[model samples]
Target: MIIENFSSEKRENKLNQLSAEFVVAGGGIAGVCAAITAARKGVKTILIQDRPVLGGNASSEVRLWVLGATSHMGNNNRWSREGGVMDEILIENLYKNREGNAVIFDTILLDKVMQEENITLMLNTAVSAVQKADEKSIEAVWAFNSQNSTHYKIDAPLFCDATGDGLVAFQAGAPFRIGAEAKEEFGELFAPDEAYGHLLGHSMYFYSKKTDEPVKYKAPSYALKEIEKIPRFRVIRKEHKGCNFWWFEYGGRRDTIHETEEIKYELWKVIYGVWDYIKNSGNFEDVDNMTLEWVGNVPGKRESRRFEGLYMMKQQDVIGQTEFEDAVAHGGWALDLHPADGVYSELSGCTQWHSKGVYHIPYRSFVSKGIDNLLLAGRIISASHVAFGSTRVMATCGVGAQAVGMAAAVCKELGVQPADLMEVTNLKKLQNELNLTGQSIPNIPIRPESNLLTQARVTASSALTLSTIPFDGKWKKLNVSSAQLLPFEANTAYAFKVQVNASEKTTLEVQLRKSHNDKNYSPEVILESQVIEVGAGEQTVDFKFESSVADQQYAFVTFMANPALEIKCSEKRITGVLSVFNGENDKVSNKGKQTPPQGIGVDEFEFWIPERRPEGENIAMEISPAIEAFDVSNIGNGFVRPWGTANAWVADLSDTKPTLKMEWDSEQPLSEIRLFLDTDYDHALESVQFGHPEEVIPFCLQNYTIKDLNGQVLFQQSDNYQTINAFKFEEGFSTKGLLIETEHPSSDVPAAIFEVVCL
Candidate 1:
């Protein structure tokens, strides 16, 4: 005989009361990442989403491409990728939905959330009511699920508002601001001179398909009758579809939160009008078979109410590239300011200004200034309008989400509020925990409390290697004795090697110049030069320079075009280190066809020219600077920030047997051995836009072996592509030293690592 816990009336009412350490609102990637982080940290967490599917803008309902540090479309962004849970999602997506299907992506997010047993996820449940525990704390949230006709009252100690519109914050009475701030407010340069209540606006998207048979489109009754009256409507061509129709926006003057429904209808009307014009207009061809495949009813919004936090990100901090001690996340996207009038503004789609390097996002931005338990994530976090323009990107918001989630765990564990975690010691613990979990916070190394790796002396296989290349026995001359003019963008110091062709045994004087702007790609300041002489045919010349023009964003090498010189160029483009000019139409495939090699799109400039375009990964330039700025000990130093000079260990490919060894001063007690491999310390595991435009570079050590000092094999992994490597002994062991042998991936790449922890 069994006894029932609930009464018949209670069971009939379908009321459920649940409790957890954290309650997350919104099922977008931000909320999902936050919930996953907390759940993985052993905190009892519950995630609530108003929609059935997760991933707010990236969901099937509205497929906004994940654009982050790549700055939407690569405005000279280097070593950019949002790692941690965001990268984990991307990797899983690549493995399962390599084609980037929206539905598959939805399932992937769901699968990840479901995998964490500590998290209780409620779908299609809207949080309608909140019960305040006190003036600053939320005791419980009452939500309703119409699908199941049930009411859920979730009681939690901490809460996160990952909702794009900041609904949770609004309902909780957390102080927030709507619309743009005046330039005088935060002394912002990008802000409007006068304050305006107008917002960026709402946008809907549609996709069209080409069927074999003819298809027709009937304009919606509410579609704008005189589409020509609208600004920028004439620019719409039939070819524009899906994410391409980002300009179909509306509702700038109206309250985006209160009048969201009205904005949605307005954007829909504009979309239909644009679609009708594309199909009916005589100017558009190849529309005989095109039909609307999918249209977004749910508008993806840009800005709404932003809750105030302990610290607000300002424009100066972003563009100035301030090195903050509390930077928990980073963004490299330009300060993209769109007109408040949105779709109807007679201005360029948006104005953008690039940053010198990736800008930092502080943890204080997520902590609520007033609400004790409330934390802000995603677009709703505290930031000026100018800074919001960059921070609002999906990938950056995702990074903030992980940060806030990890902080929430610390709050629950320490029995403290979100605001209390900002103290130095407390923050260090949280920061170290985040780094241990693969989240990168710039400059800040994981605390040196109990790390044993710092105790071991670290040495690597090869310390120096010169860049070398073997050509396919082909060369082209620039009408004068010259070396191929290879262009690149380098934010920091770099070493360069160029392949050149010379006639009559001439010496080449390489003059390095930095570009003044994106347009007119010609260099401004004449920095330095290196002389390399080559014999008649094809030859590779190495130019090792000490002084680097690290201040500029653009750099190019022009070989003095003499009659005795021939310049050879390659197609492959390197990040900040190398790439050939894009405007070369004379590119010939190795098959001797008229196919041009894929190169950088310097479409705006006509200056830089390529010689005979070599196909494949041929940047025609290689740079391997001395890693003296970094040492082997930098790996276990616990500073996990990508690209931070002190955060990684780089081995030169020059050595015959490239290896890394860790020797203890004496026989040390070692229970576990952890190895971190350098998979290109700067290039993160994050990608924005459609799927992954790039992959984990081949810089990752492909083959490696680990041995003890007594010549004993402990562990061996031959196929390695991941950035982090960890190993734990079942019991415990005492050893004097450890040996890490790194073999050449092919004969060019060397071994590299970020951190190695010994426990």
Candidate 2:
């Protein structure tokens, strides 16, 4: 043997090197969405994924359901579904994979990436080495492709750690924290008193099918020995399979990363033993034909490592519905947190509390605080343990990913890092851009510089004006009891006015009701009914109510019903002012308590009709305007809340041909026009896990035609789809004004423009 104990030549390992503008790690929903957004904007993007297929937990291997603002039908999440890419993905699944097949879902995700020409997808590749230029920036990443046994050296100017565990951030020396933070650290009510290195845990689920013949089962050696030791195992049924048993989770108290394989083994035992109980325990009802079709080999994880960012979400932010100026996303899920012991815990599966509505998520939560070149999305973003319980869902994470991707593209254009996005002026520009892409940021208004409606004077055929806000003073049909909402600032004087028309002689009683508590939606406090006598035709009443409303309070002016009284319907949609406690035929279910379908329909299209009339058609009552003439600032003052009732100008429904007309003081550069047609934004976009609803919306504008002032037809569309209508021309024309003639299926309904945006 030679003294040196080595060959003269040193071994050299060959590696494949590639360059890109942006490199995203992980192929989960967040990574997939981020890569898609950047690639579509012409960013040279590289997506490295450890799995063979896309969609981390949502893939066929893990079989976890894709849940977001809908919260899987819990938490009274009406109109809370996510928009943008998430909306497209859910609609696609409903159309293509109606049966909820996981295999077909994988193809749908793959198809999305393939459609983007600029995205370089490398699957079955695990990132192993991180090369840093200095202490602050990551220069390159080396990932080994397991499928082909090749090492890839990927170099990019900017990087996104969308991996759920924050792998790239950890390896790049980025500042981050693992496990839980102490209650005092963030002042989070849901946080633990003492900080612990524990996680929310990993979960696995199984699927079952029915068979004609009885199926037999043999327990594997690693199967859980004691059936009595497992919790929530009796829930297995013939119709019950995936997502129904998210409680079948474990491995939280142990190291979720280093011990992942061991945790997977433990989950398998629990899954098989649970199925055995359903099949052979003899306590089951009709299970002779029931058999396990598939069991997840890989456990789906909920939480792992969270990286530090400019802002960390706290429990107070969620419970208080804190408004952030730089908000880019929202979450409506309840403050859901689990015991660290997971399935083995003696306590219940989880503790949950709902909020008033959706809470805002600021843009500051997307970038790294210390690192210049790194950004993060997905479950690994900066947030307290309790806050993550709500934001960790796939739909919410996808929105954060979209924000990060767009920010990356903007950074490239501006020649800056992720930190520069926090500038006040730049943040507003980003918000404006996001609104254009159909992302909703509650309470934020579109700036006037780009808002076309703000620059043009608008006039409608007829608008049933009420208060400064639309729909707050409207009353309508089968007046079992109608309520008008009064929004007032503290210490400000408010005049409550009511105009009533009586078909037959009846008395109108008005009650100012106050909200009881958080749990119940009932406005129980009757602040004394101010009654008034009304004759046939019309009568007006005015009252100066007691000034006790605190800041941001909404008082319901409840008007007790009189069968003899009928309010005429207004052509313009009045949003929420047409609140009726109950119709003569409306009844609740006999079983569980049901929040009556939010929009206009459940079994019938009742939402389209605001109020019921005893002898005639349903219509909204006309409210005298604060100003005599229509204002240009009326439509696009920017707030599009109250869902269906945003400030809209109504065209004359009775005119031979009703048209929406806009005029400007000077020639305005107009290439594109967007119309916010009236559709039920109050109702949600369903996943179709339940039965599908009516495919066509009756209240929305059905057909429309557009042309210049000269009457030359520019564009036209029929069999119109969706609540938001857009018309675009590449070769734009300079014009002072354009006429929009909308055709409706029914003369009773006219085109109501909530926001008419042009560019």
Candidate 3:
């Protein structure tokens, strides 16, 4: 061992200075998406995280499931799963870790960030100080890593604060609000009063495992022994663990940021106390073999400081379903708020108010109002408290941050401030760029001027004429009302014939319904009704509706609740086709129907949700005239996902080698081609806990090949399982005609694609 001389001066940590085109703080889903999107756009980026791993609340450290607009498929937002980089991550996780192992999720996030060569990732680093260049611009940021005892000075032209708590915005003197605004502030009738609590709180989770041998548990001295104090303690059972205790929360009344430690301790007291009750109170069975597996140290935070931006989203913006011209993202989770007293409160754990459909999130809400170089993201972006209730979920946050990331890239390219992109000329550019990546803005189709395919003639080898879905699957009981969503081409009336078995003589009521707003799945408008006379035993019910649809839309062939009958289901599953049931999903607080209080400023509608696969089979029916919307011409319609109608080109199931051909008058130079296929956007790919049934969505294309005029293969991919498959060819080639051959993922499902673009 070598001896060291004593130093007179105080020891200083090592200092380092780094620079990039863009900088992002926090490594949650929002921050990860932001940095990944920016880096993918060729912007030199730096991503700093205070933790060792990414995913923030969704990390193994916190263990909260990743959910957003889809809301566990428990709400009326059908086919509303987030897209772009957020979709990429969720789908990748579903493919690789459908079991939802939290540790595996952590690896996926890390792998994605590490794969980006443009991203400089700094883990276990915290932003401790801000250096402003002027009154409204950030010069640099000062962050320190305790793990290495190093201080860093990171400089970038643009900075995004996705740190949930708005640390960067807070330090830069940006305007922000901490608690709920009064009802009069935004005309939000859903705003909470003082007694109802203003801010959402923090939560912690723990996992328990059962062993063959008996296991014993010992409670610490600080454990909460008085379990009866918690009002919902009786709801806990031996089978429940981890996210089952999402309501085990605290610290809404206290400072969520500064008192996080105190809140964590309180959560610990509750967790150990509950485990003690299950192990020692003699209230649960087979608990002697159960032992605590993992407990989250850092609490999963819900709400904190919300930064002010160019425009703040209010309750009306969400409830009214406003479509902003500068719409960059969407939100559909209910306006969910919790009681201030948390677990101790006698009131319900949460109050969720849903809208009629998913609402647009404007780009104005992402740019800071004061700071020119600063961009806001995640739950901290501008929004009133009542609106924050819907936008604060992790998946919504991820997509919002993705929009912000793309905006930062555009700002860098145009040499302008973040707010400057709001102009009509610039806003469309941003929206088009996002759409190119398969991020859909509701009601906004890709511009014809931006896609070259719109000018070419598109034709398919064979298109599907869907007249029937044979009754080769299961016979589902009519425990609740069920409906089959059928896409109609235009103002056409269609008749349906369905097979059903009745236990007793009963009149089966059939109604044709549609959404008042064509784009939404909420069926509120009844077009026609028929009460059919049926006798006991299996029989066919014929429904003929004379009224024609006003436009091309999905009409719900609904069978009212009649417990005496069982309807047949089809084994075949197709893209943009589903069977929904008006039922309750207790996990998401949908009690069959939503009947809110008179003055809550919300809609009352029945929740029609599709069951998870292996159970959500399509209803077997025969149509008089087949729907012809699945034509080759649909490939250039500009819409990427199903909108008001089935905006997809589906080949006949018998066509084993489905081919699409595109030809131009003369030779055209091309370098890139993007294929937007069907990946069942309706399924909510929750990051953890809730395991998925299939590794790959059945509608996705498994293999495909692109050919030139000479019949030479230009590009080919096998085992493809994503919604978007983009291929780029260096040293571009000239082709007068292009042909695409696709293989269906399975025999029962037909080959389908939404859009194809050549650049």
Candidate 4:
């Protein structure tokens, strides 16, 4: 496993400077994700990649689909919510590339690096040499980009080697192990009896589509004669339709550069031969049009030089045999091995060994053991051959990136090197940050809920006293009973009592409900009780109740003391309809409806009572339509109208006659009124109003508005106007026969109200 430098020429031409807080080498998935994470944490970061594009193996040149653990597995499950940067990339590409699956890979990787304002991407740049002032710390590095024929000397407090090749560790003189370790070292069951000269090979991926039309094919220009003797040259079913990565067999045994060159030439020949066999070889004739969609220019290397981190992960660690205090990531993939060379050669064949559930990955595996500042990510992390076999996948590599970036930020913030930051406290902080961002970490068991009580207090006023108690525990079962002991009941109606020490005469209204779901339903019964005020201290107040309770139901007790000492009974019902629409086309129609009402064209119905109304009550009609994509033809014109304007009004039904009661002792109450529609195309109110007679309140209007002070008579005919005022304003507003106006004149209206506000 020897790597030749090839040249000593300094390709870096730029001045050396200390700028970024962190420097990330390699523009692959791991590197880019690392840069993104670091930048998101408010760190000034720089990303350096030898390739022009950000994505390394999954780039267009090397088309590889990113794979995580099995869809159903836990611990090893893919937690994509860790929304620092990678999540953003996936979402952007998922929306942009609807036709091309591979495009998603490229788009996601590029977008992450591009969107981060704190991250600087240096593409087509390769690190030439490491500048270290101490045995463990890297002061800066010299980098050269062949594309620009220039050099750059970058200085940073933290450096990451996401290059998959572990180049930084190689240059920094890190103590890294390349080949398989002796069995005595790790004691892994899968390890060879002794160290052996064997390594997994790389592959050049290509995609093909089978069509209906007939077509001829030829083998790749680099195909070898030995390929004809291979037995596994076949296509397998994949997730995508009409697309397969089946023709990927090359760069094994022989020198990668030399073999890849040869395989490139032979692939075309192999493809044609395979297609010919399927079409004309008597056994198969249905397959005629085989289309080649993509071919990899760069070989997808599986095994390569691995950096030696402070801790070398072994297969035992993956078998759940070891626990690490500094665990930053978890791996669960099986031990999959690909032969080193030759078709089905004894040592170069594919084999797999499954392990137990989840394994811990230590932070030491990220930073180079010999060099202090350089942190390695991706498949090149410090691990034995067998261990690397289980963690080499893209998803695992992304996890490694997250760990390294988080560690780098921690190091930068604490003024410590990555190696030193591997302490338990620092690592825990890193793990917390990763978990907060949604990355999956090894689970540490947590005790069930205890210490249920959070806080409790009572607020007293002359008229009314309100007491609120907060509980942290999840409510399992609740009951309310009195000494006039109401028996504790579950999911049934019951009256409860509390002993109170009162100083003066007072009346109490007792109710029970859960905090979160409390306001949702009205209590079956409200117990009325009286208490005499005490000088001080505690007092027991008993409440009596009659019960015919149902089974399997639960209830909590709540008590309210009437400040005014008045008795009253009432019932209120809240109702509203949800509308749906096509989000993509802006089509207004009831379709897919969501809770809290979300969809392309959905609207929510809401009601509000204002304190300023005469009855110290306010009534509001609201239509909250999703307008993120709504098209308003004209600011003041083309406004959507209420279903029916004349019948929408807020009034006090408590009066002898519901004569538009607009005043209340507590607050100003609005009376009955009708929403009017002016036929003049220019004067359609975006929102209609029907509150206090003096206030021509607007309802459900777009935010924009226009004015018609010029008084231009656009419509002279009286038939164009509609006056609505048929319903009564009650204690609670109610609607019947209310027809929403969905259409309005196309002309510009004076103002379009997006929402209604009653003050």
Highest lDDT scorer = 3
- Least accurate stretch of 10 residues (summed lDDT) in model 2? 600-609
> What TM-score does prediction 2 earn?
0.78
Clashes per model (N, Cα, C within 3 A): 12, 9, 0, 83
- Order the candidates by lDDT, highest first: 3, 1, 2, 4
Preferred candidate (TM-score higher): 2 or 4: 2
How well is each residue in 642-734 modelled by candidate 1, as lDDT tens digits?
A: 442324565654566777788888887777665655443233232222454334445566677778987798888877656566676656577
Q: Rank the candidates by TM-score, best first.
A: 3, 1, 2, 4
lDDT of each: 0.69, 0.68, 0.90, 0.48
Report how far residue 263 has shifted in candidate 1, in Å.
Answer: 1.5
lDDT digits (tens) for residues 245-266 of candidate 4: 3224444455443355665544
Tens-digit lDDT string for candidate 2 (563-608): 7775543433333233434322211111112233343111111111
* Per-residue accuracy of model 3 over 207-266 as CA lDDT, tens digit each: 998989999899999899999899999899888878899999899999999999999999
Among these predictions, the greatest TM-score belongs to: 3
- Model 2 residue 31 CA deviation (Å) reads 2.1
Clashes of 3: 0
- Candidate 4 global Cα RMSD: 22.3
Question: Which runs in model 2 stand beyond 4 Å of their true positions?
Answer: 1-16, 76-78, 92-104, 234-236, 461-634, 640-658, 676-691, 694-703, 718-727, 743-754
